[model samples]
Target: MKRIQFQETGRICQVPINDIFGFMYLATFIYFLPVTGIIFIYIAILKYTKRSLIIANVRQLGLEQTRYRRELRFIKRILILISIIFITGVPYLTFFLQVNIGQSPMPSYGHRISFMFLSCGQGLVMLLAIFYADDVRKSLRNILLQKLPWIRGRRIGNIIS
Candidate 1:
């Protein structure tokens, strides 16, 4: 019967510092893994390609310009994956924490806090992934343009001989 507001203006509950810290630390750690994965993916590409990292990176960027429907499909898949991970992990974590850690005398909202942090962390990863994809698309587009300048317009049109 109680409704929790997603945003609020005043203090509603008190939480223990350790629980809060646990939430933040765990969330940040999980978030870092995927980010590290993305970075390593780039590094691996650079090593294998034996090309300028800058050029290679730009080449990847052009994937974004694909028609809108494909982009939307990719975005939907990423979001669904993010949601599934959070929904599955958060409840399991909450149960584990409650069972092992014991609820506070004041009635713990620790799970809620932890979920907030986790969701934020997951959101960060999803957002970064989207940006990385777009960067790859743009970079590829740029590389193509550089290699074939005439795709957009005449090399030297109206002004001279």
Candidate 2:
């Protein structure tokens, strides 16, 4: 097997390739398996929701005017979260595979930056969820205003968005 070793700040990281069961192959598969499942489940939910709503003729009810709108908003938020995770994770995947496959040498800082971005992906998702909830967002905004009263007249809500 081809093995790569790199050291930074008194720490060394190694990756081994050249076989189907290599570190790169196994790690990438394990990491991406959940992503694949999330996308699959999202699609299934979208299809089920749309089919059921349409069959029920929600538009004719004269009361559920926001049914599709609400459903789409919920689904769109989920899609955004998934996209954030995948997009942020791509950099590390590329860097790892490129190095392990011998296409390029991994720059010491590249992997670190990629890992930071990947780690922050979940944080971004959490922030999105928190800000999207009406009560939480309002409470947070109020707390911010209370803590920093100078920016009261300005667009504090815009910052949360």
Candidate 3:
């Protein structure tokens, strides 16, 4: 097995990849995990309340209902995506916290699996948004059509038809 040497203590330790990532999980749990959860809650409440306010004012203020609704929906989707990402990271945080506090032994594969899920959460949410939100789908489609020649022709043909 591979090992890392420490000069200060005159000792060499064979730290597995899981142990290395376990430290990262602990660090994230101590530092940013709570912050992420708090921000998720804050944004969720703010967005939904703001959406309600907009709905209440639409009739009296003669706001453009369709535009407001679409914007609100987009905001809601973004909040949901953020919440999902934060939730996915919670298990890793809990596992690391337990290990750090000596409540449980170091997890063999759970840390790596949770880390993978946490890392991919943002990209997964974005992909889901592309399918869930009309605005995102249209924007991505337009960008792809502009940058790729073959896709452009096919998309244009489909649009025309």
lDDT by residue for model 2 over 1-161, one digit each (tens)? 45555555325565533233666466668667877888898899899777867766845755444676777787898899899988887887777687667767667577577768978997998899887897897888889889989988888767864
Arranged by TM-score with the best first, the candidates are 2, 3, 1
- By lDDT, who's the top model here? 2
> Taking the candidates one at a time, how many backbone clashes does each contain?
14, 0, 0
Q: Rank the candidates by lDDT, best first.
A: 2, 3, 1
Q: Can you write out model 1's per-residue Cα lDDT over 1-161, one digit (the tens) per residue? A: 22332223224532233355654565468654764565566456445444443454566555533433454555465555555455646663665566556753323554566667667766766665664575665665667668877864763322111
Q: Which ranges in model 3 have alpha carbons more than 4 Å from their true place?
A: 1-62, 132-161
**What's model 2's lDDT at 85?**
88
Alpha carbon deviation, residue 25, candidate 3 (Å): 10
lDDT of 3 at 131: 73
Cα RMSDs, all models: 14.5, 3.9, 7.8
Q: Which residue pairs in model 2 clash with each other?
A: none
Decide which is better by lDDT, 1 or 2. Answer: 2
Please write out the lDDT profile of model 3 over residues 66-160, one tens digit for every residue.
65566677667667776787787787767766666666665566556666777787578767766786676677677767777676546563552
Backbone clash total for model 2 is 0
For all predicted structures, in order, the TM-scores are: 0.28, 0.70, 0.50
Using TM-score as the yardstick, the better of models 1 and 3 is: 3
Q: How well does candidate 1 match the true structure in TM-score terms?
A: 0.28
